[model samples]
Target chain A: MIITSKKAIMFVLSKIEGAVLMAKRGMLIVLSGPSGVGKGTVRKALFEDPEVDFNYSISMTTRNPREGEKNGVDYYFVSKEQFEENIKNGEMLEYAKYVDNYYGTPLNYVNEQLNAGHDVFLEVEVNGALQVRANCPDGVFIFLTPPDIKELRSRLVGRGTDDLEVINKRIQKASKEIRMMQNYDYAIVNDKIKNAVEQIKDIVKSERLKVNRVMPDYLDSLGDEI
Target chain B: MIITSKKAIMFVLSKIEGAVLMAKRGMLIVLSGPSGVGKGTVRKALFEDPEVDFNYSISMTTRNPREGEKNGVDYYFVSKEQFEENIKNGEMLEYAKYVDNYYGTPLNYVNEQLNAGHDVFLEVEVNGALQVRANCPDGVFIFLTPPDIKELRSRLVGRGTDDLEVINKRIQKASKEIRMMQNYDYAIVNDKIKNAVEQIKDIVKSERLKVNRVMPDYLDSLGDEI
Candidate 1:
């Protein structure tokens, strides 16, 4: 009778192990592109779509929040001193300073969410994305690109605020960023926001089903069953 | 004048090279699974769906053609002697002798289709798929799996034609085949045909966008443009 009960407990524990194996750690999907490539627009559309499910990582910033922006929602408002301290402690996954204000992703929040089996989405600039890659090499780095150089130049020029010299400089900067796409895992052409979102959705689905990501846990669960 | 014309011709050639680079070679997608895992059902559903675009590779067989089965449509019916000759000459990608009849995939046909930038799809038995993997290591090998061991046992018994002894034998064979799924690139659970089909569609889309597959050609097309 003792042996029977012990066997029963072992069977139950094995079943629980199988359940744990099925709940895989979530992926970090980084969306980045050159200036004027509409990365933000596509990301916003993706979040708004009901079919797209991901936890958006709100960035921590030292800049004063604009009107209608709430703390912890739009951004985690932090002081420059606190931000610098976090950076010193290696709490920032990626960060950048603009006009004397610091903007950064918090490593603690991303790790917490990912450990809980929730995918975290990050929208960042090209250089900032490279920094994130350095920190988290396994993150899915998707580089969004314009339909063509002509379209990219026109989009930059369409702002109608910059002079011809400024426009040319911006175009050159964009070209340099486009070249950085070779470092990414996937390059998506941002021709249509909906199409780009769909491609990204497919990418996430496929990534989840990847053998390397899921097989180790599965093999562990099998554990001599074969 | 000669230098000007020569430069113009070089420009045209470069554009053609870019076009050629854009047309990447197609992939070989092999779908295999244990018996009673419903691989055939999922493949049929995938092909029936309009969104799934792939050229199905018609197998060559020496078996007698059934009624209403047209040559080159269902399969390329060939004589046993010709099939053996092709096999001896290494023209077969994968082959098997079942019930005294030869069945195989023609390497030339698969290569012709793939080189023409058409994705080729092949459905084969587990052992036959292993043979294909040996011949084409780069193929996208997807293993369809039953949801669980109970479901697999029931599926084998559900045929209703086999007695308990035969059913047990089939279950044992299936367990061995299931172990082979570790060799595959992706293992999709066959819970629902529609869901499996959707996953496969995502896999194809994501595979097409893989960096390793498309990057070399894209870099060549850039040709120092960056």
Candidate 2:
């Protein structure tokens, strides 16, 4: 009887420990969309909401910091050489170069925060988001889309450029980006920022309740317990 | 210029039509769990919430209508021969015999409601749920679970049954049902009915936003528009 009780206690303890470990592993959420589809605005609004519980992944950049930008807060301002070195060593999760300056998500910081059970949120351009997807295929990828194709085209045309050819080119680019929505798990139309935020919050809540994510730990813990 | 304008109009019309069609196809959601895990209570609470938009699927049963049980509202009470005939004709989505009484979900009603864009909700036993899964694999399957195995055991014991053997049998059966949660898409612990309802509502919201379900119509509509 004592032996059986000891075995039962051990099983319960292991189950509790497994639950703890599972709870401590946080999710990674990547939000990306077409250039003029307001990904940045939605992300900012989401972060400003006190109900949103996520740690924004501060990116590392080789570009000169703008006025009032703080190191390690706004971004981890790094030398071009240091950024290149990190890329060479694969310490960057995803990186892109624009105007001779490199900007990238650091792998180490994301891993650290995830291990500490803090959901890490990344808002990136479509290309950068693709790169992140290649590295972390399991991350929740959300693609934000405009209300409609006409809306997207109108936004491109209204971008303070009366050049017809330039507007056409921007529209084509937006179309390509919209096509990339197929690569994402969920798509939320950015009709209103508040609506988008609420949908995203619900998505996170639903993902957390998914059986695939929550059951493996239980199965492992219940091994031979029954 | 005339041809281009005509083509654009057709494309836009087709896209609008596709969106309308997509919006009209409703989702099928199944809620199931162990026999005594309070699936009925949670489902009741969910339906009582004014925010839930799903239509409760009334089941058909081959049993005498108890006090105040209406024919169509409470259950589609039918003769055993009729129920068996429906099962033989494959008109039943799922059916089971309990206490020598036949109970089943009617496929025609569910399909008609879904075609009309009414999200249909089903609360069934695990076996019946598996049958539904076989017929409608795309349905959202939510498994209700106890907060913990210990809690499950206590619930079984507290059922006013002093027979140890019966209690053990109940526990073992519950374990098997819980293990079957692997076949489900989501698991919401029935710690509190309110909490479960919220989680379920969030899950439906997220499922509605899934790219797999929403983008197919967009892609089909945009076939040559881009």
Write the residue-wise lDDT of candidate 2 on A1-226 in tens digits.
Answer: 5456445545666665666566557889999887788987898899889999889998899898899999998799999999999999989999999889998899998999988888899988888998988887878999998665555444544454445456456556656666789989999999999999998899998988888777865565444555
Model 2 lDDT per residue over B1-226, tens place: 5456445545665665666565557899999998888998998899999999989999999999999999998799999999999999989999999999999899999999999988999999999999999988989999998665556554554454445456456556666766889989999998889999999999999999988877765565444555
lDDT of 2 at B81: 92
**What TM-score, computed on C-alpha atoms, does each candidate reach?**
0.82, 0.87
In model 1 chain B, the worst 10-residue window by lDDT is: B217-226
Q: Report the lDDT tens digits of candidate 1 across residue range A95-126.
A: 99989999889999899989888999999888
Over B80-144, each residue of candidate 1 has an lDDT whose tens digit, in order, gives 99999999999999999988998889999899988888999998888889999998898899999
User: What lDDT, from 0 to 1, does candidate 2 have?
Assistant: 0.82
lDDT of 2 at A173: 69
- Cα error of candidate 2 at position B130, Å: 1.4
> How would the docking of model 2 be graded?
acceptable
Q: Which stretches of candidate 1 lie over 4 Å from their true place?
A: A1-14, A17-22, A149-175, B1-18, B149-175, B224-226
**Residue A200, model 2: Cα distance from true site in angstroms:** 1.0
Clashing pairs in 2: none
Give the range of the ten consecutive residues with the poorest summed lDDT in model 2 chain A. A153-162
- Which portions of model 2 miss their true places by more than 4 Å? A1-24, A150-172, A220-223, B1-15, B18-24, B150-173, B220-225
